[model samples]
Target: MIEIEGLSMDRDGVRVLDDVSLQIPDRSLTMLIGPNGAGKSTLLGLIARLLRPSAGHVRVDGLDVFRAASDAVARKLAILRQENHILPQLTVEELVGFGRYPHSRGRLAAEDRRQIADALHRANIAALAGRRLFELSGGQRQRAFLAMVLAQDTPYLLLDEPLNNLDPRQAISMMQVLRRAVTDLGKSIVMVVHDVNCASFYGDRIVAMNAGRLVAMGSPKDIVVPSTLRMIYGVDMSVHEVGGARIVQPFS
Candidate 1:
């Protein structure tokens, strides 16, 4: 379980996160949704230990995130940020191999190779393994980054707006991949998403944040209602059930 107590962050004297306390359970796919500057990315960064919280403590499975060794934390959780900067000349295989650094240190053993292959297969990027990073399109690059995170083989995966560059087809595929990871592999996946419909469709639990605070959190059925949508986004929309799934239509 991931626990945050009195979580708050300050940047240049501006409060990015308020006194927020939330308990995110394990073995579930949690979607974080909010408007711009709602602290969604900041919250993910804090949970991943990329940014230190000014006045709170973050714990993953009872281990204090800041107090634990970096290696220990890396083994438990892996993050895929929005921006990635690496040697453009590196092949996809090489980039994926870096994910095993926490386990292989420098030299990849037999098990490391097997894991790399599995990650590549999981992300549907095996055929492009020999291609350089710059050779792939934006969506493919996103999948490569996801493959790298999967290669890390951590129990918790944190993704920040992973669907930004994806087309509709690629976006659906990515969501299915994450769903498989949660259902088949039992990995805990947390992601920040902008599309409310996608979040409503795929998330086991939807967490809505606004103005640096958590406005609502519940199952898809609970969060996809008209009142909840208005409360979180200040927008009026109609919700319809299609084959047992709730879909929000914002425009008439």
Candidate 2:
């Protein structure tokens, strides 16, 4: 479980997060949803230890994330930010291999090789392994990066708006891959999603944030109601159920 207590972030005297507290249960898929500038990404950075919170604490399974050693935290959690800048000349395989550095220490062993292969397969990018990042399309590059995160083989995974430039098919495929990771491998996946429909379909739990604070949290059915949607996005939306999954129709 991840426990966030009184989390607040400040930048240049501007408060981005305000006394935010959350508890993310283990082995569950939680989706964070909010409008722009709601501090979702800032909170994610704090949880991943990418940035130090000005106040509060983040504990991953009782281990203080900020106080823990870098290697120890890396072993337990993996994070993929939305904006990642990598060398354009690097091959997908080489990029994925970097994920093993916590364990391999720059020298990949047999286990690392196996993990790399598994991650490529899981992300459906096995054929793109040898291709240079610049040679691939936008969606393909996203898949390659996702493969790198998967190769980390951590129990907790945090992804920030991973569907940024993906096409519809690629987005669906990625969500399915995440579902497999949770159901088959028992991984805890927390992702920030812009598409309410995508979060409705894939998330076991939906957390809504607005103005740098958590506003609502529940199952999709509970959080996707008309009132909740209006409260969070300040827009009236229609809700539909198809094949037991809730979908939000924001544009009518």
Candidate 3:
């Protein structure tokens, strides 16, 4: 389990993240949903130790994320932020190989090779392994980056808006891949997504935040209702049950 105790952040004298706390369970996909500037990504950064909070602590499986060794945290968790500025000339395989650095220390062993292969296969991008990133489509590049995160072979994975620039079909495919990762590989995944329908469909739990504060946290059925959607997004949306999953319909 991951425990976030009294986490807060300030940027240029403005509070970007208020005093917030949350507990993420193991082996489940939790979707963090909120409007732009709600501090969803900020919270993810804090948990991954990419950014230090003003005051509070993040503990993952009893390891103090802030004070632990960098390699130790890298071994325990992997994070993929939305924006990646890798050299476009790098081959997908080479990009994925970087994930093993913490364990391999720049020299990949047999286990590292196996992990990279497994990640490529699981991401359904084995065919693109040797292809340079510039030759791929937006969706393919996203998958390549995801493969890198998977290759890290961490128990916990955090992704920020992995579907950012993809088309609808691509987004669905990405969600399917994430579902498989959770069920087939038993990874605890926390993703920041804006599409509430996708969240309702794919998330085992939905955690809603607004203005840097947690507004609600529960199963899809509990958090995807009209009332909660209104409170979180300030838009009155109608929610229905379709195919045993809650679906939200936005009003114009």
Top lDDT model: 2
Candidate 2 ranges beyond 4 A from true positions: none
Candidate 1 lDDT over 1-92, as tens digits, reads: 89989999998999999988988888899999988889999999999899998899999988899899999999999999978998989999
lDDT of 3 by residue, 146-206 (tens): 8899899898999999887777876777788788878998889999999899899999999
**Model 1 stretches astray by more than 4 angstroms:** none
Q: Pick the candidate with the highest TM-score.
A: 2
C-alpha local distance difference test of each model: 0.91, 0.93, 0.91
Question: Candidate 2: RMSD over Cα atoms?
Answer: 1.0
Q: Which tens-of-lDDT digit does each residue in 1-252 have in candidate 2?
A: 999999998889998899999999988999999999999999899999999999999999888999999999999899999888999999999999999999899999999999999999988889989999999998889899999999999999999988887888888888998998999999999999989998998999999999889999999999998999999999999998989988888897
Count of backbone collisions within predicted model 2: 0
lDDT score at residue 213, model 2, on the 0-100 scale: 90
TM-score sort, best first: 2, 1, 3
Q: What stretches of model 3 exceed 4 Å from their correct place?
A: none
| Ten-residue stretch with the least lDDT total in model 3 | 165-174
Q: Between 1 and 2, whose lDDT is larger?
A: 2
Decoy 2 TM-score against native: 0.98
